[model samples]
Each structure stands twice: as C-alpha cells, then as structure tokens.
Target chain A: MQGKTGSESWQEVWDKSVNGPRALIDCWQEIPCDPCQEACAQGSIVLSSGICAPPALHAETCNGCGKCVAICPGMAIFLVDRSIGSGLARVTVPYEMRDEIRLGGEAWAVDGEGNYLAEGRITRVSGAGRPGRTMLLTIEVPEEWALKVRGVRGRRKLLEEPEEVEAIEAVEDFAFCRCEEIDYSRLREIITQGEFRSLPALRRFSRAGLGYCQGRFCQSILRSQFLADCPEEDREVESFRVRAPVRPVKLSRLGGEDG
Target chain B: MSLPCEQLDLLVIGAGPAGLCAAYEAAAVGCRVTIVDENDKAGGQLSKQIHRFFGSSHHGAGKRGIEIAEELFGDCLKLGVDVRLSSSVLGLFSNGEVMIDAPTQLCLVNPGAVIVATGASEKSLAFPGWTLPGVMGAGAAQTLINIHRILPGSRVLMVGSGNVGLIVSYQLLQAGAEVVGVVDTAGSISGYQVHAGRVRREGIPVYLGHRLLSARGSTGLEEVLVEAIEDGTVKRFEADVLCLAVGMSPLCDLAAMRDCRMVYEDALGGLVPWHGADMRTSQSPVYIAGDASGVEEASVAMEEGRIAGISAAEDLGSLNSGEAAERRAAIAKRLDELRAGPHSRGKLAAKERLYAR
Candidate 1:
C-alpha cells in the first residue's frame, strides 16, 4: 500500500492499473477531499489519511464500479478498459454542461487541459435529463490514445489565434488610489521627489493609503507599481504598514463617549 | 448614554462560514458565544455564492455554497449562540476592548477571548474608465446576480481566469447574460481545468496570455481593450460590464488593531496577522480563523475555525486538555490534507512561517 505521507508514485499507480476495466484518477493536486472512498462499496479505494488524502485503488478489489466517477467534485476520476476486444478502448468521463450529448455520435476528445485532442465515437450517455447532476459519457477511442483523452466537446468554431505585435507602452494614466484619486503619474512623481522607500513613507507623503477602506484596495496596486520600478535590493522590504481602528471610528468613539 | 462595558467569555466577529463554525464548536462545548457581523444577514460572502463547492462531504462539497452557509448558520443558532446582525465591531483595542455599533445602541465588550473571522475582500484592477458604473468586481456582479437576482449587464468581459472568474462567468451565462470572453495574463489556465472546461464547452473563448489594457465608454462601461502580454497583440470586445476577478486580500485590519504580530505573505494575500497552529495570534486573548487568517477555501476556513474555537474553549477551561488535543489532531490532519496538493506548496510554506513562534 502507498503510504499517506508520500504521494502515490508511478510504480504504485501502475501496479493498480489492472488488465480489465478500472478507475483512473487524474487528480494530481492534494485537494483535501475523499467522497470517492465513501462511494466505493467494495472497499476498493483506500483513504489512509482521512478525507484529504487522494484515493488509492486496490486493483484486485475494484469491480469497474462508476459510483466514484459521478461523485467527484473535481470530476477527475474516469473509468477505462483497454482490454475490451477490437483494438479500441472505452473511456467514461463525467459531463456537467447543458449541451446536447447524443449516443452513437462523434465528439472531439480533449486533453486534461481542455485542448482538442482527437475525435471519438460516443457509445453511451447516462444521466441525461437530470437537473443538478453529472452525466457520464462513454466514448470509444484508439487504445493508444485512451489515457490521454480526458473529455469531449462538440465541434465548435475556434477563435482565431492572437497575432504577435510589437510591445506597447503603458496606456493612459490611471488612478492608483481611488479614494484619494491619486493617478499613476502622480505616484511616479512622488516616488522620485519624496524618495519613498516603503509603503508607509509613500502613504505619509501622498495620502494614498489613508482612505476609508484602509488601503485594502490601493496597497496591493501601489506595491506592484513600486516593485516594477524599484531596485532589486529594495524590493523585499516594500509593504504596507498596518495600524489600529481598522474600521473608521469617530474620535468620540475612541474617547468612550456616547454617540 | 453608552451602555457599560460588558464582560463576556468569548466574542466572535463576522458571522460567515468560519465565524459560524467557530461559534458552533465553542457553543457545543457549553461555552457562551456571541457572534457579530456588519451585514444584516449572517452569511457574509457565502450567501452570494451560487456555485456548488468542492471538498469532502464534511466541508459541504457537492452542495451549493448558499446551502452550506444556511446549514452552518442554522447549526450555530440551534446551539443557542448569540448572533448579532447589523452589529459591526467598530474597533478592537490592544487591551481586548471591542467597541461595537449595534443597530440600536453603542456597546463595549471586554471578552476573555476573541476569534477574528472577518474574511477577505476582492482585489481590484484599475484601468482607463474602470471607475465607470458597469466596471465592478466579479464578486460585486455575483452578489448582484445571485443574491439580488439582478443582472449587472447584458454583455460581460471577465478579467482573470481563476476559479472566481470562471465560476462567475458560468454563473453570468446561467443568468442569461452574455459572457463575451474571459481574459487572463497567464499562458495556462490558473483555475481547475474542470471549471475552465465548463465555460469552454459553451464556446466562451478564454483569452490566455492577455492583459486587460483599458475600458472605454462615454458614461458607463461600453468596451474593453485586451492586449496579449507575449507579443502585445491588442483585441477589443464590446462589453457593457467588465468584471475583475483578479484576486483577494485578507481582511486583517481588526487583527492588526489588536496589536498582533504581522507578517507579509504573498501566498496568504499579502499582509496577515501571524498565528500558531492553534489559530492563536501573538496577542494572548486574540485568535483568528478563515479568510481573515489567510485566503483559502471555505472548507479550510471551517477547519481552522474549529481549531481556533476549541483552543479558546480549552483555554477558558470549558474543555479538557486531552479532548482538545484529540480534536486538534484530527483537524490538523484534515488541514494537512487540504494543503497537500502541489499547488498549495507556497501556501503551506507561508503558513509554516506564520505558525513559527
């Protein structure tokens, strides 16, 4: 069994890829989740580290059950069988879109990143006409391309690819601080004139981060702007200064006086 | 006249997912809990989320966020937690004094312990004509569409391909608004591929490696100019609404006001109050959880809430040490699982630095 402390290695995953039909989980990220384990009645899926651990399958125990396929919130689980006669593989994927999915039809198969891969024949479609549910689509693909096909989409006209052009200069002056109406031009001038090294210095000189929102909106923007122009050595120490009364309070309130 | 300062055992601020879960855990342990929020309603941003959440069943995965918020709030109420809505905590003093502006009166609270779950706010991107009426945060448009049942505009241009941008774009389409396209500066999709696929299936082109240069109109937003960052190719789309889903920053103002040690963590949405694994800040009586602690999934926030809540309860002698440790271990493991994903490496490291005393 693969230990929970370490992620599943290729050998462990390969060992579980049995000859018959089995579930293939494409989930690589350690998303803290485990509904797939609960969905498997045969106890085929092992979650040694509770819900957050990725589901580990025992090849011998899995019965090609598709319960885990529909329940995965990420829709990363798939059912595949490469040994089903006729040089072809059957791959089942979850579909949640509202498009019309038909059986005995052709669809464009896509890779894990949603890029168009190859065309596959749709053999079966389940859970249609149900609202708020995941539909499973089984497609027949070339045995060589079975592992790569993640999902299928209808043949739609793709937008023209963006063309290459010369680098453009920064556009017209835009406000950096909305509450104070401090635009970018004014910020650049202040940064040079005041020789502001930190956010507090700039805030003290320009009143850019002293608005009602308490620099929540402007601080990040200002930091990005400063870092883009500042020397590399001074970049690490540049950040906003946090102070009290995070919310706007009347002076009377601070004095403990009744409103 | 101002009401005299009231001494309480525990006070939780911002009755969102984290705060609600915190209140529930502490109150379940037979500790008196009083929760306050600025909004008239208890669910903070959870009420505006129409998309189904993703996590284990314990985090309400597969359930819509709105449903989870209702369930969490309901659980807190059933436990007899005192919930004050439209009651904003004006200021949190260094001495543990909390000044609250209730709907009817001004009150001061001196609590034995405080849990700050104030959550995070949407980060905005500025461009020409960005201040136009139709140019707004994606969350604002989501609130308008999902909560208020009003479409922000007819044709929308979404900037940022993160989960919020993708989900809100899908939601906009579901609400009968046309999503012109989604623009992002990154070459690859940043959010989950499943979410990106949902929009791609609908023929909504995701313009990757592109940055929004400007929004233009006479009065309201009418069009947006997007330029490819790689080669500077510019494209313009006619859009009445330009929704920015760039990112979010943790709402740590209250924590900062409490004189808690602060640190700059880019992964945690910039500056955040430093805290330990138990969710207690450097300040003895102050604790924090949820997005306010650091922006993560509501599921992670809920788990952190339980940790903070139980820690407070145990500190106040409401729970035994053995029981608190057991519960903490389970939650810590869950947190580890959540942060186990490769994408969370930076966040996990940032949290480690935060947890270091």
Candidate 2:
C-alpha cells in the first residue's frame, strides 16, 4: 500500500464519489463476493465469479433502481450527485425515519465525511411499512446543500450549538430504521403512487419493509412513527402484510447438509 | 461443579476459541481431554468471522478468523481431542458429573479441570418500525454477506460505533452498497479511530451522539429516523438502513449457572467469570478464556485459551508444573503484547484480573 496518494485511482474514486451506493462495501476491492450481482434486478452490477470476486458496478446500466441496495450487506454504496444543478443536487438518499415536527422542520445537515455544513427545512415527509418505522423527512436545502448534507447527526449528546439542537428537540416527529430504506415519507409515496393503496396491497408494487431479516429491528419504531403521523387514526398495524423469514437461515440450513 | 473425587484430566466446554484451545493444550501432552458444547460445530464464533483478524503474526494475526477456526478445527481433530457437539452440559455437579445431550444415551463426563469460552451476543436498539421487515442485526448483516454470500440491503443505516459496526460498515462499502450513515449513541466513535477514519475518509458520515427515534415503510424498512441531543435537546436525520453497533454484553450464563465467582466490570463489557493469568477460575479445577469470561477481541481470547489449556494439562498430570509454567509464560507474554495496543488496554486490564484470582 502506498501513501494517502497510495493509488491515485482510489483517491479519485472517493473524490468522484465513485464509491458504490451502499455502506461498508468497496466494489473496488478485487476479492470475490457476488450477491450484489444477483441482487441487482436490472443487471446493473455483476458478481460473475463465485463469492470471492468483487462486484462490478456498470454506470449506464444503473437505473437508480435500488435492487442492489436491498441486497448489499455492507451498505457501502450511495446514489451521490456531484453534479450541482440549479445550485443544488438533490441526492435522494434512502432515509428511514424522522424526529418529529412533521410538516417541515430544521436539521443540521452533515456531509458524507461527518462534517456539519448547512441548515435546511424538511421538504417532504413520507411514511409506510405495515407498522410505519420512519417518517422520511426530505429537507430541502440550497442546491449546494445537496452534497454538503450526506448524513444527519444521531443520538449522541450534542454539545455544539445548544439552541439549535433544542429547537429540533422540541419538534418530536419521526424515527429511523437501518433496514429496507423505507420511511413515512416513502411509505406515503408508495401508498399514493397507485402502488397499492393499502398496506398489504402496497407490498406488490413497492415491497414495503420486505427484505432479508424480515423487519425485526425497525418494527416497533415504525409503528410509533406511523401513529405520530396519522394521529387521530387507530395506532394498530392496521392490515400491514408480514413478510416471512423473520430470522435469516444459514445456507447450510437451506441445503440441509445435502451439499 | 469442577474437578472433585478422583483427579481426572482436562475438561473443556463450548469448543469455540477458548475450549478448543484448552483441548489442544491438554491433548498435546496426552492428558485425556474431554470437550462438550451446545452447538454441533466446535469453532464457535470463529466460523462466523469472515474477515482477517487484526494483530501480530504469533496470534494468528492477518489470517481471516474463519480460516483460523478451520485450522483450529483441524488440529483438534488430529490431536484426538474428544469433542461431543450438540451435547449440552446440563449442570456442573459437585463431584465432576456433567449431564449432556448426546447422540447416544444420556452421558456424563468427569474431568480434573474445565475451560469456559462462551462468546458474546449482538446488542439491539429500540426504535419504531424496528420490527418492520428488512431490519436485522449488524452480525446478521455480516452473516448474510460473508457467509451466505448475500447482501443484507442495498441502502443501510448502521447504528453503533463499536469496532464491529465500523469495520462492518467498511466491509459493507466493500460489498458495494450505500451506507446511509452510521448512528452511534456515544459522543465519540467507540471503535478504533483508524477503522472509523478509513470509512469517514471514504465519504461515509458518522452521526455520533444520535439515537434511532423511529422507522417507517410498511412491508420492509424504507426509512431510518435518528436524533442527536445537546443540552437536553434533540435534532434528527433520516436514512435507509439502521445498523446498531451499540455494545455487547458478555455471555456468562453457563458459568454463572455453575455458581462460579463472577464480577461486573464496565471495562470488560459486562459481568464475567472470574479467572487468572493461567486462565484458572475460582473453582481451581475449571479454567476459562476468551469473551465468555468477558468481552474482549479475538486475539486475547485465543492466547487466553492457550494459557488455560496448558494449565489444565499440567493439572491433569499430563505436563509437569515446570513445563506448564514455561509454556504459559511464553503464551501469556504474547497475549500481553496483543492486549498492549491502545484499543486492547482497558479490556486487557479487566481480563487480567480474571487471571489474578
């Protein structure tokens, strides 16, 4: 390994944000793991070899179709938009939940490298899932704010800018689920998209909350986010479809020692 | 519950890193070693670790942990160490009687000493929509990726700032998915700064001091709701996946059930069975090594396993006291070195006290 400039290409990849759309994965590492290849519904990536070859990301083939997203275990990829258009590149990331203040609230946006850059108002809030885990709040910042805010600060004792943290604190609206990438804002979109209005019906079009682990981590959190948004309605799951495989099975279990 | 009545040979349980180490040590000197474990596989957590371990060469460093486990499995087989899997040792009877779940009729094993090496469990977070489909544990994420050769999710929101969380997040990036971001409840990154820095430099953000408030998306997880608090106030962010690396509590139930002397130490990651440098426990005849005693990394666990097994062999009269002492002194020095780095210091201290007893 060379220095930080070790391989100019590695740095270029990061600078260009050529890093994949998931977290913890490097399509660049020349190893072998192809689930990402199989995960892509649109054939955007390839894992041709056995499980040792690193996945190949084909730019033109990528439809921004989140199939690879659902299958990637590392969560290392992201749909980054370095192209600043209209002074702002809205990188529609996969957001899971919110803190409160449904209509539109303030958030201290952070860039991909954990730096605080700008302020923004919540633009859109969507909620879905059988139980409704996150109320995805799409905050609209200046076009430049797009790249500046890649992430949001989470549940630590925020000692910086006390007054601002307090303002958001008093707001109380959503939740975050580190799975399936669905939130209230997203759920609402799925419901309204004529993508099957009801919870179970929505399963066909959007596959809300349907993934490998089968929704164990974000189930309760989403329920509260749903009730928080709906309010006057009954706080029940209210007909959400329960996907199977709550516990992931080992390949050995699947093959049953037959292999 | 340990060795009583006639002094027997080496007694080992759980057959993972710690138990396997003890078995090998006892077998090296031909000390009738008997190993029992609840799982059919004896490698324990080693089978699940897909990545190369971080440490020096002596401790099997640079070798992928799974490979190390495979090697250990092979050694134990060749040594003729008695390993009974799916054989749950029901109790630690007063006179060395251990009830077990075996392939044949009910059985019992009485040995001169024992080694405990049960590992740790994945910690979970409380969040709305957390129970929705698509959500899983960080370990589960790794299991899906490295073992099953599958991707857990394309977009992920990882929680926890521990080494596992950070390292896994990095691995996730390697797997080619969008790491929505990392959400840690602590003010600072809990894992190695180097691990965190690598990913941070890669353009992933770490949301320290944040909590997962709730999550949405009906059939599965579509969004992640997170909030940060300062001066008793909260701020929020939303992301796709919710990976929690909060912390792990040591698995001490089996040891605890035996009524062995146990103590709680924050540095050790929770309560653990009492042991000493040689890996001997308060019960004298029983020895324990690795995370089961407390939550430490893999390197220390393996070294500790070696120490305990050697000591168990000597106790079984297989190895002379001088020989056991010589072997242990060497392994302990290496173990101490592995535990010397900044990351291992506090944990090493807590684990050292187990040996002190």
Candidate 3:
C-alpha cells in the first residue's frame, strides 16, 4: 500500500547509489516476481522467501550494470550515480517506448510520479539493438536531482486534433444493445414509463437483453443505467434473469436438428 | 435428425489458462477430458498476452503468456485431450445434459464431471461515444496489436489505471502508438506500483483523480473528454482510439442457468457461482475455476483448474481420494503463496468467503 519509496529501507539501500552507479530499487510491495533476482549476475538482489516476497537489493554487490533495470517487470529499478561528475549525476531509466531517443540529446526529466522536474541530457542508450527488449536510457542531470529523476519524457507529443473520417455513424442515441439497436434513451424512457421492477420485465417490454449476445454485453449497462439511482434497499434484488440456452442457439439446433 | 447424446468422463469449458490446465490435469490421470471453447483458438486470452508473466518458475514465470499457453495446450494434446475449438456450450441442464453447439453439429454431452472455467468478460464503460467504432475494450486492442500485429490506432487515450490499463498502455507504446495519457477516477493507482511506474516512466502521465466525461467522435473515435474528480475541471485530448481498461465481470451465465447457488461478491467483480475449496459448485458434478469463480491472476486460475481437475478425476474414480487429496494439498499451498501478497489479499479473502458459504 506504500506509494513511492518508504524511508524505512531508503537510508539503508539507496544511500550507496549516491556513491556510484548502483541499483535504486523502489519495489515495496510483496509481488510474486523474481526476474530481477535472476537477471542480476552479481547476486545483488535476493528473494529470500521465494518469489512472492519483495526483493531486497544488496547495494554493495550491485555493479550498476543496468541488467536488472531492463529485466524488471515493474520497471521499479533505476541506476543512479552522483559521483559521475562534480555537480552532475547520471540516472539510468528503463525505456520501452518506440521513440527515437538520440544519444546526447536534450530530454525532459521526470520524477517518480511522472512530473516534469528538470531538463536532462541523454548520455547513453543501451539495448537499442535488441528487439522486444527494454532499452535503458541514461540521463545526465544535476547531482542534487539524481535520485529524484526516475524517468525521461519520450519525443512523441499528444495530438491536438484527430483526423476526421467516418467509419461507423451513430444510428441511434447511444445504443447499449448493438444487435437489437435499442438506444439508451429508449431504454430509459421505457424503464420510467413501464415502471419495470426487474430486468426481465424491461427486457420483455424493450427487447434490450434479447439479442444475439443474450445480454452479455448490455446487461451491466442496463443495471447501471436503471438500478444505479434506485434506493440502496431496492438495488440489491434486481438482477438479469439468466435463462436456459445462455448463448444464442439456432432454432433448428434447439429442435434437435443437426446442421 | 436426432441429437447424439455423448457420454463424457470430464468436460472443461473455456480452454483458457484455467480450462486448459484443467483438461491437462484430468487427462493426465486417464480421465477422458473434452475441452470446448467458443473461440477458434485454444489459449483464449493468453494469445494476446505478449508481456512476460510475474510468478515463480513453477508457473512459467519470466515467460510470456503466449508461450505458457502454448506449452499448456501442447501438454494437453500430448495427453490426448480432445480440444474442440469453435465450440460453444449453450446450456447446462439439471439432468447433467450439456447442449453444445460444435462446429460440426449440435450435440448433447452427459459429462460425469464438469469444470466451468468460462473466464471473465471485459466490463464496458458508458460514455457518449463509447459505442463508437474506435472506442473499444483494452483487451480487444491487445489482441489486435499482440496477436494480429495490427495497431488499433495512431494515438490512444486509456481509461482506468488498473493492471490491464497500465499494461495495455505500455503495449500501445510498444506498438508505435502515442499513448496520450492514462486517466483514472481513483486518487491513487489501483494496480501494482510497478505496473503504474512502468507506464509512468515512459512519460505517460497517470492522470489520477480524473473521470471520463465522454468520448466525442463523428463516426469513429476522435476526441476524449475527462473531468477532474476533485474540481470538475474538463480536459480534452485528441485520440483516434479510446481504450477502456475497466474491470471484468465473471461470466457465469451457464452456471446460473444450471441453478447453482450464486453469491454476490464485490471484490470478485459481481455475482459468481458459489464454490468451495475443492472448486465444486453448490450443484453436484459441477465445478468452477479461474475467473469464472472469481477474477484473479491467471496463475491462480491455473492452480484452481488443476485442483478442480484432480477433484473431478477422483470423483470419476480415475484417481483415488487419497492421491487426489495429496495433489490438491500441494496445489493449495502454491495457491496460498500466489495470493499471499497485499495486492491479492482481497481476492484471497473473497475466495475464503466463497468457501465458507
């Protein structure tokens, strides 16, 4: 439940990252994963209680090779070195986006929550040649912000306007039932007018649930649209009546006729 | 023509991560297993999972889901399990008659023991343009990109910050699409911090406290509108595709039709068939496993399927009760270990409640 790196193990595990390029793992939850432990060649990471336990990082044994960064499924591991320069630090982040990250290029640095902190330069790009592998982007930032910079912004920008092309037009007023083409407005009108207490009653009146999907797609939508506003005491009883032939069956097949 | 009534030793529904493991386990014990799935493929949702799984090596950890699915199905085939793809089970009658709509013909199967591993369905989010062509489920987009190698769109906006949402957002980035952002109504991320961190470190903003207002598009999806849950401020982003990674509902329509007692567990998504620790439903000869029982990790589903298969085999006299109990104990230990994490504590409690009920 702890978001961000907690202070209980931060001083013991992450202080060595300031000395040299060491793995600064922020994994706090007990996830059943051990790829980082297997990925480390120096025996730096240990999962003492099998795979379900949270991994412990042996900072002194970590050589900052960035292998754990690439193999970590959570992308919680980072390599930081405050001793890279006099006042500059280098942080290696696991990058998976298909952006053309140029070496020695200016990139916007981000913190743990993905907030833009400061501009950093991409100093090295590793695992670029390997396909389907997580590449590491090493960024050079201020020495004080080395531990803070966890990631860098990709080059892709959000689209301001989408191209207009008609693929499927709106036939009805937000139809939840695609097969029956019963609009949400129509269902709401029927539910209010008919005073239907159950979903089967509404289905008989509006034919919303009687579709090829057998209400598989629109059942929840119907429940939320109608019963969501009902009184809490009355809300628990209304459920879609599941009948025989749960899936759509051919009339011929139901009649014991072979196809 | 009369419908042929076929007698089956064991029948497993779905053929996904759960059903395949169930069929494999039962067939390994010499219980003539027949697995049926509506899809043409056997692996179900696992075919779309390109990212590696996050369990121990016993469950094929570090291997991609696609690989694990292939290995499971291959093992089932080696055991001579009959995997009928493109087949649907229409109904489960009280007299142990299961009406199946197979690719070839309509038939009735009288299975001595049945494991309903029907899995879960993606829950849809209702918005103005939610029914649009490009506004699709995140799992559908995953299938398109990972299985079919086709990108759903150039720019995408994902709703929900769960594991599926964050993982699909990362996959969308891998498919060369510009993931504009991931918006969720919750103040904090719902999935593991690692998954959220994985997507966040890619510069994909996790817009926590943002609820989707509507999606606007003329014919297809063109723009998405979100509102800040705290201040009610609106934010618009241009996106050709709007992916809904909302939670899933356990598909138990067949089980419900069979008169199996159902329990409503919010933690397990919705109403699920009441089952015990042995995966046996309230009704005799009916067992439920995987997401059909409760939506949890695929690893847990596979373990549950194995237990169900072993229990069914023992009931069918293919395995002795003592051996079945021993095997189930080992699997139960693994299941407990898989659900020991804080992330899975709610699911574990929900499962125990089902057992207690």
Candidate 4:
C-alpha cells in the first residue's frame, strides 16, 4: 500500500549492512506483467498465484543477469553496488527523456520522492534494446547516498557557463498571462537580456502580471527561467501561482452543456 | 486436453468494443465471423462505462462510450455476425484454433484470423487496512453507482488522481455522496486538467504529493490515513469508501498463454500483444485489436478492431482486397482523429513503439 508506487517496491536503506555487488530486483506493483520473470535468464524472479502478484526477487540465488532489467516494462528494477572497490559505490537506475546533458557534468542526485541531495557522476550504460531497451545508468556517489540516488539532474551547461545566454529555437504555445497574448518566446528574450536578469527586472520589461487572469499561467512558468537568468543576489524561490477557475472558462458564464 | 476445431474466416475473442467492431467490419466484407465473450452481455467494458467519450465525429466524440458500443454491436448483429455470450476462451491452440468453454459444452472454433480484445484489469493498492470491505476499484464503484444505482458509501476518500479517480470522484458527487478529497503520491495530477478541474471546482481538494499510508476500520472502512510525501507527516481522513485509482494494465493472459507477440508500453497502460496495422500478431494469421493489443480508449479500440477485421477478410479472399483497403483507410482516418488530440497523446506515445517505423 504505502510501500510501493504503481509497480515499484520500497526497501529501507541500511547504513551498516555489508556492501555487496548484489541488489534486490524490487517491484512496486502486481500488474499482470511477467517480463521480469520471463526476462530472467538465471531464473531469478517469481510471481505469486494471482494475476496481479508483485514479483519477488530471489536475492540469494540471483546471478545479476541483466535480462530482467532489460525486459521490465515499468523501468522499476535497478542494479546497485553498496560499495565499489574504492568505497565509491555506484548505483545504476534507468534514465529516460531527452536532455542536453553530457558525461563528466556534475549532477544533483535525488531519491524516490525526487528530493535533491548529494552530487554524482554518470558511470555506465546498459541494454539499449535487448528486450525493452531500458538504459542501465550507472551513477557514482558517496556510499551513504548509494541507495538514495534514484535519478540525476540534467542540463548543467548553465552551471558550467553562467554568463552564456543561448538562443532557444523551437517553441510550443504558452502565454505569459492567460488574459494577455504575451508569448513565451518573447518572455525568454526579455528575461535573457542583460538589462532584465532578475525577476523584478523581467517583470518590469514584460508586464506579464498586468492582466485580468492575475498571474496564474505566466508567473510560475517564468520563475525558473527568470531565476536562472538573474544573478545570485536576486534569486528568490517562489512556487507557481495556483489559481482558481484553474481551468479555462467564463466562471460567470459557465458555457459548457449541463450534462 | 486436445481440443477440437471448427474452421472459419474470422474469429474474435471478447465481444466488446473491439470484437464487435471487428466482427461487423469482417462480416460486411462477406467473411464468416464469430465473436466470443465471457460476460453475460456482449459489450465488454462498454456496458459499464456510462460516461461520454471524446473524439471526432467518426469515433463518436461527445457520445457516451457505451452508446457507440451498442451501435457497433448492432451493426455486428445486422451483418449476421455469430455472437456467443458467456463463452470463455480457454486457450489459444497452435495456428488460428481456439478452445472455448460455453454453457453445456467445451467448444472449439478455428478461423483464418482472430482478434483478442480482452481490455484492461483494475489495479489493487495495499494499505494497512486495505483488505477492508469498503475498498474497491474506481471502476467497481462506477459499476455500483451507474449500473446498480447504489451509493458506495456516505463519505469516501479517493486515492490516485488519474482520469479514472477524477472522473469517478465527480460521478460520486452526482450520485449524492460526499468525496472528501483525492490523494496521490505523485506531485502533479496524473489525469486531464478538465477532469481534475471539475472535481476541484466541487471543493474536493486534490492532495498531490500525499499517499494513503494506511486505512483503519473494524468491520468495514471507517477511517483512512494519508501521509505527506515531502516531510513524511501523517494525517487522518475519515472515509467510509476507499477507492483505488492508482492505474490499470492490459489483460494479456489470453494472448500470452497463446505465445502471441507482446511488449510493455507505458503509453498503452501495460503489457499487451504486439500487432501490425492490420492487427495481425506474430502468429501470421492471428489478429488482435482493441485494449487487448494495447490499452487505449474505446474509439481507437473499435477502429483498430475494424481495421483488423477488414484485413482478415481481404486475406481470406471473402472480399476484394481493394474494398478492404478502402474500409481500412476510412477506419484508419477515423482512428487518426481519435488519437490526434492532447488526451490521445498517451496512447500515441504508447504506440510509438509501432508508429516509429
């Protein structure tokens, strides 16, 4: 119940537990799926009798065969080393989605809940498309944070070169203010410029909040980019403007069918 | 046991949206068609989904999903498609043969082509008191309210913010029940904004980043507990009905037991049989359509069934290949509209494994 997400399970991290090259193939769900069990060449995984039984990994007999990792559809399984030979344990989890990232870039690793913590380095990549094409991302970290580092941050070029302001080419439809036509493309231009490097600076240039919709759609979308463009002295962390009518509609006029 | 076989032009398993569509299309092409389903009624998921569907004109946009299913089933009947209800397909034999358990007899049917449209299975979530009697899937709740006109409970706590959870929350309100709120461990609502907004406007606070840590009840569900994902803080919310809308997975046991080509695609919901544009799987003549191939809305599932049916008819030489192509084009065109919108993107993403080529 509280132990797993869809098909991923929860295992408490033990600090004093002996560091081994072994890892438990964790599953959070019992989703009528058998790729992990079927994918296991070493006969490592077994499912209960029910159609939606969560798979239990036979830790004592598992041979570290990468077959199950390649075939798990949920990308929930991972390989971990409690401690590498040099005491720098490397944890490998699957990483997906496109990012402008490269090797050797410093990354802030996060846990299952996505809270950012200690930094790590990319160490290895496994099966691209053997059965499911899940990439085994090997990340090196402190032994204490080995079990906690489930994912890594992408796009560190900004941290590397603070003064650089690269031009953005492709654009999707996003308005700075729902009531106004302030396009995101224009907002980016104004915020990236030297004249408006901070939130207050960009606010002055765009008049983004100067609309009837208050600043619901526009403010938060601009917050991160605005903070990134601004100098360290002007960065103030704020959440997205959570507004009502949170959906688009004439609240006073309710135009949809009653049904 | 070695089962007997009866050869035919097309045989469809699960006479729901997919099977009905496939049977109607195949029969229209002058092919002998047979549709088998386990439920007492012919329409699989359709009989239960009382909500309106979204899509273009072809896919019955704005029409209740169940209505479209009825129309397809009617067309199947008009086309003289032999439909057998309460017929559970036991196993898939080698080639296109199938073993079925019908009332009073264990029958067999073998067609040149077959379509599997088993649809999806509701997921179960576990909490400290999850085994309580008041807990159920959102679909089960919908069935109780819409089909039987019975309120699940006086006050309920919905777990998961996916479309099912959100939609069911609103439906519960319509049925005169109090929905305290929805809790999801994920930070953002997993469903469409419209569905979430409707529930939100009703003052049902959707607690993103909250998990149902535990549930406590004596004989039935009386209280539930939620925990903040951020700080691990726990809070109690009194709930009589605890509905799980965590997610669903494609029911591919029938396909898998037959060794049909299958794969895992999050876009489609879960594990499903791999099929071609015509719905033919690795077993050359065997075809599958609807949710059995992958988890998708009824509109896409029907169109996929039709396309498979037409393709099978053409292959069986029951209709001109040119006629089959025309029907496929029209159905394919309709499927495109259903799968083109923002909502269909997930299904599109799920089928990316197929659409990539």
Number of clashing residue pairs in every model?
1, 166, 0, 7
TM-score for each candidate, following the candidate numbering: 0.81, 0.57, 0.87, 0.56
Better of 1 and 2 by DockQ: 1
Q: Using lDDT, give the best candidate's number.
A: 3
Runs of candidate 4 exceeding 4 Å displacement: A1-259, B1-4, B355-357
Q: Identify the leading candidate in terms of DockQ.
A: 3
Interface root mean square deviation per prediction: 4.4, 15.9, 5.7, 26.1
Docking class of 1: acceptable
The CA lDDT at B88 in model 2 is 63
TM-score computed on alpha carbons, candidate 2: 0.57
Candidate 2 residue-wise lDDT, A1-259, digit = tens: 2111112223332344332321222434332233455556766565443333345555544555454433333333444343434544333333332233344556655555656666665554445341312223344556545434445433222323212233322323233434555554566554444434333444444444465544444433333334344433422233343221212434443334432
Please tell me how candidate 3 rates in CAPRI terms.
acceptable
User: Which RMSD values do the candidates have, in order?
Assistant: 5.0, 18.8, 4.6, 25.2
- Residue-wise lDDT of candidate 1 within B311-333, one digit each (tens)? 99999899999999999899998
User: Can you write out model 1's per-residue Cα lDDT over A153-185, one digit (the tens) per residue?
Assistant: 767545444343444466788777888878878
What is candidate 4's CA lDDT for residue A189?
78
What residue pairs are clashing in model 1?
A: A30-B341
lDDT of each: 0.79, 0.59, 0.82, 0.65
Clashing pairs in 3: none
Query: Across residues A1-259, which tens digit of lDDT does each residue of candidate 3 receive?
Result: 2212333444544567666788878787888888888888988788777667777777777788888888777778888887666788888888766667889898878887666777888989988978657789998888777767777876455333323233333333676688799887777787666467666677777888687877767876776676664445544443466767777777777664334
Candidate 1 wrong stretches, greater than 4 Å: A1-29, A44-66, A77-170, A211-216, A231-258
TM-score (second chain) of model 2: 0.87
